[model samples]
Structures are given as C-alpha cells and as structure tokens.
Target chain A: SAVISQKPSRDICQRGTSLTIQCQVDSQVTMMFWYRQQPGQSLTLIATANQGSEATYESGFVIDKFPISRPNLTFSTLTVSNMSPEDSSIYLCSVVFGTGGYEQYFGPGTRLTVT
Target chain B: AQSVAQPEDQVNVAEGNPLTVKCTYSVSGNPYLFWYVQYPNRGLQFLLKYITGDNLVKGSYGFEAEFNKSQTSFHLKKPSALVSDSALYFCAHSNDYKLSFGAGTTVTVRA
Candidate 1:
C-alpha cells in the first residue's frame, strides 16, 4: 500500500482565481492520477500525470481548465485554472503500483470551495 | 470503457451482525474490480480486489469479498459490523490504466 498526502486539505477561494493542489507519495510509483468529486456525487477522473511528459486528461476535461505537472515520479501538482463556482469539489490524488495490478492508493484529497 | 454499479444508496446493519455491500460491473474483455472505503474527511482506502484469483478474497477490518464472474458482481461482506464501520463505500472497475468508480454507497452500522 502507498501513503499519499495532499496540501491545503480545505480551502476557500474566490471565483476566477486559481488553486494548485499538491500530491506527494511516500514512495515512487508507476503512475499518478487526479480525480474530482462533486458534493454528493461520484468521483470523476480528471487526468493521468506522467513522470516527464504532459498529463493525459479524460473526456470532457481539458488541460486548459486543469493543468497538471509531474516533474518527478513521487510528486505532482494539479492546478484548477480560471475557477468557477462549479469547480467547487474535492480533488483526490491516486497512485498506481504493482505490475498488472488494479489497486490504486488514493490521497486524503483537497477540498476546494470556490466562492 | 468500463463502468461500475453500486445498487444501494445506503445500507444499514446492526453492530455484531453480518453486513454485505453489493457491487456489480460491466466491462468488455477482462475485468479488474476493487472496493474502497471512505471515512469522514478522509481518503478512499483500498479494501480488496479481484483480478485473477480465487472466488473469495479477504481484506482489512474483517472484510471479505466474493467475485462472481457469471453475475459480474463483487460484493463486500463482514461477519460483524462495528460502529466504526459506518462510512461510505465505493466500487470501482479497471480496464487499462484508468479505474472507473460507482456512485458509492453510505453504510451505517448501528450499535
């Protein structure tokens, strides 16, 4: 199992501003992923961060709105750019490990409230 | 694309009683299924997974899950429920690198 941590566990920001959430893993991992969960809703995959390249985002999500940076294998940051009230949600980071393994260890998540 | 379904919005079980959280999935080709638990203000904790193994898999906190390929189901079970067991549970399915999650089910264990 992997121990992941996020910064700014909860924050309140004004609309039109940007908030960058950080994710750090206790150990190196094969892959890292970002997710968003709306209040009372299911979790949605935002993007997959690569070690030395651009992140791969899911459908209906673009890098312009959720820019991701992964400078190394153990750390990554996801920035919610040009935030709106609709962007208020809990963002979680997950790391993939174990060859041919399906389990993903997730971080506690950063709760963002866009006002 | 793969999808998961958690049939119940909430499940209620008496403490010391057996509990089961139902989960079903739909995917093309092979399926990688997993269960997760989330406490208040906490992250989703890995419970158990059924990739390619025996029908039943055991996990932390005295929890177990059974993988039934014919039903496309992987249900979480516990012989005894604790008050601490009251939390939200999510079912997820993986096809490739991405893992899809269900809406999640809130479980309340009564003491």
Candidate 2:
C-alpha cells in the first residue's frame, strides 16, 4: 500500500484558465499515472508520468491539453491547459506499488470545476 | 484491447442482507482483475485483486471477490450489507502496466 496525496483538493477555475495539480507519494514509486473521472462516468487514463522523461499519454489525450511532469520518483504534476466546461472533472493520481506491482493506490483526487 | 464491464448501474440492498456486484472482463491471455470503492467526495480505495493462484480473494471492509475463468467474471460479494457501504464501485483489469476500468456501479444500502 502507498500513501498518495494531491494538492488543490477542489478548485473552481474560469474557462480558458490553466490549472496544475500536484501529486506526492510517500514512498518512491516507479509508475505514476493520471486519471480523469467525469461526472457520473468511469475513470479514463490521461497519461503515465515517467521520471525525467515525457509522460506517455493514452488515446484521446494529448500533451498540449494535459501536460504531465515527473521530476522524480516521488512527485509529479498534471496541468490542464486552456480548460473548458467539458474539462470539469475529478482528476486522480495513482501509483503502482507493492512487490509484484499488482495493485494501484489512488490519491484523494482533485475536483476541478471549470466555470 | 483489455476492458471490463459492469452490468448493473445501481444495486440496492437492505442492511444485514447479502450484497453482490457483478463484473466481467475481456483480455488476451491471463487477466489481472481488481475492485475498488469510492465514497462521496473521496478518492478510490482498493478493495481486492486477483493476479493468480486464487479463486476467491478477500479484501478491506469485509469485501471479497471470486474470479471465475470459464465465466470470465470477477464478482464482489459481502455477507452483510451496511449503510456505510453505500458508494460507487469499480471493476478494472491491468494490461501492460495500465488499467482499464469498467463503468462504476452505485450501491445503496438502506437501513
């Protein structure tokens, strides 16, 4: 199990503004991921933050829209650029830990409301 | 592509009764299934996972899931329901170090 925390637990941002969410892990982890959960919807993987490298994004997401930075093993950030009403969702930070890396633990999540 | 499906959108149960949430998965070779719970205004909490060797796996908050290979199902169950257990539940599977989650199921336990 891992203890993960995200900054700006909840925020309201005006349209066209950008917001960066910070994720901090108690222990160093090899894999860090960012996810988005729309209202009443399932989780969608945004990108995988790699330490000292560019994040690997999934289909339907791009670096220009959702940029990620992982400077070290224990910390990462995801920035939602040029936000809109559709971008209002709960952003989550997750890490794969334990011996076999079979389980993933999630942070409390940042609830972003674009107005 | 690997994916999981949750058949029910919402499940309502009475307190002290049995509870069940259904999940089925589709993957290439072997499946690594997992279950997670989310309360209102909170982050997701890992409930249990089935990597290998176990047909039935137990997890936090008295929750358990049975993995049936032939049926392609990993269903979560609990003997007794509690009002506190009312929340959203998700079923997911891991492939290539990435997870694909199923549509969540909302559970409502009435007192």
Candidate 3:
C-alpha cells in the first residue's frame, strides 16, 4: 500500500479566493484519483490525474473550476479556483496499486471551508 | 461501471453487542468489494476486501464481511461493539481501475 500525505489538513478561505491542495505519495504510481465529499453527500470523482498528461475530468466538473496537475508519478495538485461556499468539502486523493486493483490508499483529505 | 450502496444512513449499537453494516454493489464483471472506516477528520482506512475465493473475509479492527453472490451483498459485521468503534463506514466496489464508494453509514456505539 502507498502512504499518501495531503497538505493543509483544514483551511478557512474567503469566497472568490483560491486554494490549492497537494497530495504526495510515498511511492511512484501511474494514476492518482481526486474525489470530493460534499456535506451529506457521497464521494464524487473529480478527476483522474495521469503523469505527463492533462487530467480527465468527470461530468459536472470543468478544468477551470477544478484544475489538476500531475507533475510527476508520485505527486499531484488540485486547485479549487474562485472559491464559494458550495466549494466547501473534503478533498481526498487516492492511488491504486498493482494491475489487479486489489487495494486503494487514500490521503487524510483536505478540509476546506469557504466563507 | 461499478457502484455501491449502503442502505442505512446511521446505525446505533450498544456496547458489547453485535453490529452489522449493510452493503451492496453493482458491476459489469466480477466484483471486488471492500469496507473502509473513517474517523472524524481522517482518511478512510481499509478494513477488508472480498476479491475471490471464500465468501467470508476478515479485516482490521476485528471487522469482517460476508460476500453473497446471489444477493449481491457484502455486509460488514463485528462480534462485539465498543465505543471506540463509532465512526463512518463506507462500502466500495471495483471492477476497473477506480473504486466507487457509497454514501457512508455513521455508526454510533453507546456504552
């Protein structure tokens, strides 16, 4: 299993501002997934970041709103642009191991509160 | 596509009592079922998984889940509940590379 570390465990941000969350994996991986958990909602896939390529965003998500960057195999960044109160949620990054996809490890998550 | 469902929003259990958290999944091919626990302000910790072989699988923290092919269910269970066991439980399914998580069930254990 890969150990994932996310920065800014919790943050209070002003509306219209922006915040970036960093996810670092202890080992190299080909794919890193980002998810959002809104209040009283299930975890929703935001995007899949593949190193050396643009992220593949899911439906209802756009590049401008939630930009993702995978600079290397072990690290990725997700930025919430033009924050609003609706943007408040826990952002988690996960990495799957091996071809079988038997296990997936998640980061503690970045708790963002937009006010 | 793969998806999971947790029918109960919350479950309350008395200390030392047996507990069960229900889960069901849908996938195109063979299903990989998993149970994860999440404490407040923490990431999801993998408890157990059911990929192949035996229906009954044991996981961390004395948790276990039984996979039923006919019913398409993987229910998590604990022989004895403790106050420390209170947390959010999520069921997931994987067929492709990504795993789909359920809405989550909050378990509150009363002493």
Question: Can you rank all candidates by DockQ, best first?
Answer: 2, 1, 3
User: Residue A52 of candidate 2: its Cα lDDT?
Assistant: 96
Give the per-residue lDDT digits (tens) of candidate 2, residues A1-115: 5689999999999999999999999998878999999998999999999999999999999999999999999999999999999999999999987559578899999999999
Q: Which ten residues in a row have the lowest lDDT in candidate 3 chain A?
A: A96-105
Query: For model 1, which pairs clash?
Result: none
Q: Per-residue lDDT for B15-73 in model 1, tens only?
A: 99999999998987778889999999899999998888698999988999999889999
User: How many times do residue backbones clash in model 1?
Assistant: 0
As for DockQ, the candidate ahead, 1 or 3, is 1
Q: lDDT tens string, model 3, B1-111?
A: 568899999999999999999998887678888998998878888899999989999999999999999999999999999999999999988656667789899999999
Regions of candidate 1 where Cα sits further than 4 Å from its true position: none
Per-residue lDDT of B20 in model 2: 100
- Score candidate 2 by DockQ: 0.89
TM-score of chain A of 3: 0.95
TM-score of chain A of each: 0.97, 0.96, 0.95
The runs of at least 3 residues in candidate 3 whose Cα sits more than 4 Å from the true structure, single-residue gaps closed, are: none
lDDT by residue (tens digit), candidate 3, A1-115 = 5689999898999999999999998988767899999977778889898788899888899999999999988999999999999999999999876566567788999999999
Off by over 4 Å in 2: none
How many Å off is the CA of A112 in candidate 1?
Answer: 0.2
